[model samples]
Target: MSWIKTRLKSFGYAFNGLWTLFRTETHAQIHLLALVVVTVAGLITGLERWEWLAIILTIALVVAAEGMNTALEALSDALHPGHHPLVGKAKDVAAGAVLFCAIAALAVALIVFLPHWL
Candidate 1:
């Protein structure tokens, strides 16, 4: 394949994975809901450009973390179909990474939105 075609094909694969994530993962669906809410709130509040940038970046971070966690969990489960303590621990660690990103996203939301509300 030509370089451009290969790049486009890769994008297609990435989008397919994202579709699977949203379709099969409840957590990803929740994140999508949160994204819609945050977007509406941002529009309603007339967030400044910098505030929008922060919100956008935070949302991306959280979503990326969740995606990574999902990938890790799926890989672990596939590799070790039987219950394993180490696999459980790896999955837990991946989940914790997602949690930390979520908390940071919350902090960013508060910093960017609290003043506007108050």
Candidate 2:
């Protein structure tokens, strides 16, 4: 009972957070859309197992980063409650991480999709 309780305490918070985010975060919904598309594309394209793994992992990474960015922005807004340059910069930086991951995913997509289509 003690061990199970500890494990749940450690991980359960994340699930609750994800559920809340799914309900409220528009970006989370966008990620869900990208996730479905990327997964279907992988299956249709017949990527090798490793390529499929890479594509799936990359998409998860993108969504995970985006989710974290959304969380930070929410928390930041709560903490600041006013427009400040530093707060704005922090949000921008968090968003930039999402952008970087998205660009990387697009590159992976090009590698995966271009040869088949062209």
Candidate 3:
């Protein structure tokens, strides 16, 4: 029972963190909108099971990367509290990670949907 309770509490905290990201982050909101659009497109095109799986995984990867970037930025800011070259570099690297994931996801989307569109 105690173990189960601990796991549940961890889940609760995870959900709360997700809520914080969506509530406070503009990038998260944009990603969510893009997710909705992609889901709608996938449904409308009748994506195959494997295609659906790929799309879902790609979306999750991008969002997770964005979340990680946000977390890093927050931590960097909290630790430095002011301009610091190292902190700036850390934040830039985090943002770049998000960008890399977004680009990969976009490429996957194009590969998956271009045929349907054409």
Query: Which candidate leads the pack in TM-score?
Result: 3
Query: What lDDT score belongs to each candidate, Candidate 1 first?
Result: 0.94, 0.85, 0.94
Model 3, 27-62: lDDT tens digits are 999999999999999999999999999999999999
Q: Candidate 2, residues 1-118: lDDT per residue as tens digits?
A: 9999999997889888878877788877877787788788777877788788778888878878988898889889999999999999999999999999988988988888788778
Instruction: Score residue 67 of candidate 3 by CA lDDT.
Output: 93
Q: Which regions in candidate 2 have their CA more than 4 angstroms from the true location?
A: none
**TM-score for each of the candidates:** 0.96, 0.88, 0.97
Error of 1 at 7 (Å): 0.6
lDDT, model 2, position 67: 85
Question: Which segments of candidate 3 are over 4 A away from where they belong?
Answer: none
Instruction: Assess the local accuracy of residue 54 in candidate 1 as a C-alpha lDDT between 0 and 100.
Output: 98
- State the lDDT of candidate 1 residue by residue for 1-118, as single tens digits: 5999999999999999989989999999999899999999999999999999999999999889989999999999889999999999999999999999988988999999999999
Q: Tell how far residue 42 is off in model 3, in angstroms.
A: 0.5
Global CA lDDT of candidate 3, please?
Answer: 0.94
Number of clashes recorded per candidate: 0, 0, 0
- Give residue 6's lDDT in candidate 3 (0 to 100): 100
Give the root-mean-square deviation of each candidate in angstroms.
0.9, 1.5, 0.7
